[model samples]
Target: MSDFGRKGLGDQLKEKAQPDSTKSTLDQTKESASGLYDRAAGAVQPDQNKSATQQLGDSTRSTKDDASNQGQGILASAQETIGNAAQAVSDTLQGKK
Candidate 1:
């Protein structure tokens, strides 16, 4: 082969061998851009909204506890009435009159 042709062929081979360098640079640029996007996303805050939501959750829990206690009291009262009725029936049957 002639010298110029050999030189041209070598240059083509060098370019082919170094193709990954371009891809590496592109990947690094994508990483930097993604890092910037993450930082921007992190900068956003929901401070007041979060606090309000927590307060609402606390209020709901308190209300549920109150309702549960009220229901328990009602059940206890019904049980007491049943017990009294059973005692009266037993007294009448055993000739307590």
Candidate 2:
């Protein structure tokens, strides 16, 4: 009947329509954490032998250092690829006629 009464009813309807907003946010957070874990796992390959802290022969230690450097290089390459893709998209949008 009154404007205030109608406004209260509208607010109640909105609340009832979306009761799982908090659950959706928690699910998104879990999904993001899972993705981060997977990425970190992929970055570190499985080493059959001891870690870098363990003492090893010169050749073996050098090989390990090279592998570590290679991993960093790969990360740089992936970053560059992502940057190039973003730049391409930006250029395409700006070049639109």
Candidate 3:
């Protein structure tokens, strides 16, 4: 069977690893535009009216968005940890702590 409409494991991992800040300007714009389109389509064609494939697509998009958000949270936490470590080193060097 063809899984053409589905995201592969590698693609999902890549999406999770890539934070929005790292995306290029064009890529970010495209995502934003696509999101707008999806929202408009959803408003015009609610879930109850959507076909099985379309519903699956929406569900997949939601799951991907959630994963990306979680990944961003993890990335932010890592950055915070690194920043705190750097601050501690600076304080130690300055004899403040």
Candidate 4:
């Protein structure tokens, strides 16, 4: 066989022995995309560390605390009003006119 023909066969064999560059790059791209998707899923994941019932319990506790504070404020205001009314009644009864 001519040296040129032998060289051509050798080159063809080398090419076949090597993986296709385009297919290799495409596989890498697929793996990168899969990794990105996994990270995004993890980032957007709700506090999986906490259950729904636990979160609800915390919210309920906060709301109860808020209501308790509001009730205390109202009670304070009512007591003040009553004290003022009592003072005014006592002053009127003493007839300081």
Candidate 5:
């Protein structure tokens, strides 16, 4: 099971947590391009007017977007949990909790 191109959970979480300001220029450009393409596609072909194959493509894209969003949410929750644990430990050490 080579995971070559796929990001590991830690990497994914780190990426999700990274501030937009710190993203590479290339990454930002790519995101902008993707957004533009999506907007153009939507304007050109509203959902109800798509062919069967186009509808399938749209569905696949939607599913992928949904999964990515869910992954980011999970990562945020994990980061919050870890931060809270760390804070609790610090407070205990300082006799504040």
Candidate 6:
């Protein structure tokens, strides 16, 4: 057989482990958002001038904002992880290093 014909499927295949770049990046973003949310919540204090109902409304709004922000962060992080995993799989199948 010719040299080209003699080459097996293994000979043309190459693999290299893909390094993950998302972990630290995602962690930092999550941490930063958490810190920001905490600071925002902490900054809200009972106002002596405001009525009881107004105070309650302010507290409720702050809690809601914190929950909503945290939920969004979780969702975004999950999506990023899934996308990274998919990309890694695709790269591996293509014999990329």
- C-alpha-based local distance difference test score of model 3: 0.69
**Whole-model lDDT values for every prediction:** 0.53, 0.51, 0.69, 0.55, 0.65, 0.54
Rate residue 7 of model 1 by lDDT. Answer: 21
lDDT of model 2, residue 57: 26
C-alpha TM-scores of all predictions: 0.47, 0.37, 0.62, 0.45, 0.59, 0.50
RMSD of model 6, in Å?
A: 27.2
lDDT digits (tens) for residues 1-97 of candidate 2: 1121122233323444655555477765764565455334434434333233221222343586699999999999999999999999998999943
Worst 10 residues of 2 by lDDT: 1-10
Residue 37 in model 1: lDDT:
50
* Candidate 5 root-mean-square deviation in Å: 11.4
- Tell me how far the alpha carbon of residue 66 in candidate 5 is from the true structure, in angstroms, after superposition: 0.7
Whole-model lDDT, model 5: 0.65
Arrange candidates by TM-score, descending: 3, 5, 6, 1, 4, 2
Model 5 pairs in collision? none
> How would you encode candidate 6's per-residue C-alpha lDDT over 3-96 as one tens digit per residue?
2112222221211122335447776575556546534543554366444544554566569789999999999999999999999999999999
Evaluated against the true structure, the overall lDDT of model 2 is 0.51
Best by TM-score: 3
Q: Write the per-residue lDDT of candidate 5 for residues 2-96, one digit (tens) a residue.
A: 12222233443455588879999998787667555653674466667765555665566578789999999999999999999999999999999
lDDT of 1 by residue, 1-97 (tens): 2121122323334544665556577765765565455334323433353345333433454586699999999999999999999999999999885
Q: Among these predicted structures, which one has the highest lDDT?
A: 3
Range of the 10 consecutive residues with the lowest summed lDDT in candidate 1: 1-10
Best to worst by lDDT, what's the order?
A: 3, 5, 4, 6, 1, 2
| lDDT of candidate 3 over 1-92, digit per residue (tens) | 11333334345446557898899999878766755666466446667767666667667767877999999999999999999999999999
